[model samples]
Target: MSQKPAWLTTDGAPWGRGRARLVYDNPWIRVTEHDAVAPTGAAAVYGLVEFKNLALAILPVFDDGTIMLVGQARFPAQDYSWELPEGGGPLGVDPLESARRELREETGLEAAQWLPILEAQLSNSVTDERAIGYLATGLTEVEADPDETELLALARVPFREALDAAMAGHMKDMLTVAMLLRGYHMAREGSLPGALARAMLS
Candidate 1:
């Protein structure tokens, strides 16, 4: 077998004039060039920065008052985390369709209903990427469609308890935490007004 294609690559430029330079390339992820300045002296190349598309995550809250979570191995975090059924945007699938598919594949459950609860962007301050968060409701159990690499399992927790876990830092993903917080606001208002629909776009 041959090596898998690199998502990105960077060749560092020699340091001078309080700046470091690099040429970046990408195939699967978006391609870009980065020339960062240090203000004083050159610093070691941190790594290649990826320009990418919006990610979508589905939060399935079922009628039983439980929210679905998936345990995933996060190499950067160096920990496997518990999060909602969620994933990619590069497949060119409709956002809602992605949400529905992730819900079923990761959780072994499907939603009879779906709701657009919140929209948010993602970044590490230096990199640019956005992730859309969606709230799903009215769910039912079904066979899971794991992709083998996922090794995912579903963990259902009550709404309040999920918040408790989040507050305690168990739910480490910022996108996941943000969506759950948005749901909190919706719950408090007793309704997420249609006005929210317009607000989501901006």
Candidate 2:
């Protein structure tokens, strides 16, 4: 038996009334289990997952301050639209490559330049997804080969309007909001933290 960390042992029950799967026998949380519960009482089996690592989301912005975004039918929210070029999960391709692929697949736009704008680990108090935001300029368009189920549209909203949409609950994607707003000032001024700090003070 591999040793479990001290933090994992605290305030722990059978993770409380959830599904159990003995995914890993060596180390404690190398386990991958999916539990179910009712959000509104006696509903369906919900998921209590312990995945490998956090995922990433990118705010792929281009020249002229336009953001590359995609809108699709979200089955979970029952809402059909609005999201960025994402899909940097725990597996498969690395984050930067995933960013470029998602951009090409969704928008048919490719970048000759790449800038690492913002990086973050997700709110573990809620979920475990890590995201990195990017500034991709010097773009050239290619033929768009969208997925059969993917119905996508591209919009170049001013950064302020993007923030307003998040505020008004229109652009309600969390990673989108988190990256854009927190990293907004940096994007406009074209510097990482230094120019952003100057913008904030002014």
Candidate 3:
């Protein structure tokens, strides 16, 4: 069995929190400001954004080795982005079910197999946004049901091409990048089925 790294296995100094106050609130997020002392012993003010939902991303891989991607304009970045189908899942909901919903809602695809591939804390320094990524395969097409606020475009590309584009910075969503890299790692490390890995790496 694998073990945690020595640094993680050992306890270290932790940040100390002082007074905290809510600075902003919305249906989806809550922002707070806190007086804090760093592990380095320096006093600091910390602003944190807490997401009310768990972020979910799905990499929909088809039997033919292509994957589905969604393109939309991101409000904060004010730029168009091409990413794996992603959305927010209620904190209490099963992430796989949410992933399936996001896949169908955003890209009109449903999968026969789902593999949880990655879990990450997004923008950890400033936000408490957590993300879960899934690898979806054995896909079938259906009608897309995107949210009213979204104006999305869909594309189907080879897995390698998508990974290469993400690596080349054409796809900037960190969750999407991480998922693609994780998928690549799985393919190379024999974590995936032999045929599926061959299809992905081909």
Candidate 4:
């Protein structure tokens, strides 16, 4: 076996945090500024955005290679975006349970099978925002109950079409993009059922 990198075996040197002060706070996030020293021994200032919840995303796929997408106007981007059903789970709650609620609320779909596919840190350099992505299959439809703050549009499209659109820049949500790629990898790697994998890749 190849030897592991020395850095991977232990925590190396860390940035020196001198002083930290909360600059802003809200129910959803908190911003803090820090006086710090970089790993290279350079003096620097750092700002961190701390999230109050964990990010969750769900890719709802039907057995025949179709997937569901949700569209909404995003305030930060100031543009309408099409993405997988996604929302925030309270920090200590089971992410899958929160994902289930988001999928149902946004798309009115529930899955008989669920696979946790990806875990990532979103904008790690500036934020403590982390995300979990799920591949949800064996779908059944029900009435949607979106949150009052959400005005969403739902679409069902071929899985490959959605993946291609994301690749082509039509879909820009990072979580959505990452999950689509992960699903494609799973299908191509035979991690999914043979029929489903064929349907997805086809």
Q: How much does each candidate deviate from the true structure in C-alpha RMSD?
A: 11.2, 8.8, 1.2, 2.3
Please identify model 3 stretches exceeding 4 Å from their true place. Answer: none
lDDT of 4 at 191: 88
Per-prediction TM-score, please?
Answer: 0.71, 0.64, 0.96, 0.94
Q: What overall lDDT, based on C-alpha atoms, would model 3 receive against the true structure? A: 0.92
In the range 53-92, model 1's lDDT, one tens digit per residue, is: 4577887776555687888898787888888777776646
Model 1 clash pairs? none
In candidate 4, position 10 carries an lDDT of 94
Count of clashes in candidate 3: 0
Report the C-alpha lDDT of model 3 over 165-188, residue by residue, as the tens digit: 999999999999999999999999
TM-score of 4: 0.94
Measured by TM-score, the strongest candidate is 3
lDDT of 1 at 142: 88
Per-residue lDDT tens digits for candidate 4, residues 127-152, read 99999999999999898999999999
What are the lDDT scores of the predictions, listed in order? Answer: 0.68, 0.63, 0.92, 0.94
Can you rank all candidates by lDDT, best first?
4, 3, 1, 2
The predicted structure with the larger lDDT, 3 or 4, is 4
Best by lDDT: 4
Taking the candidates one at a time, how many backbone clashes does each contain?
0, 4, 0, 0
Q: Where does the lowest 10-residue lDDT sum fall in candidate 4?
A: 1-10
Clashing pairs in 4: none
Q: Please give, for residues 1-202, the per-residue lDDT of candidate 2 as tens digits.
A: 2499989878632323465566554321254454544443453443333445435555655444556667788877898667667654445556677777767887888887777666776655333455677666667899777778778877766556666777788877787777767556664555654543343333
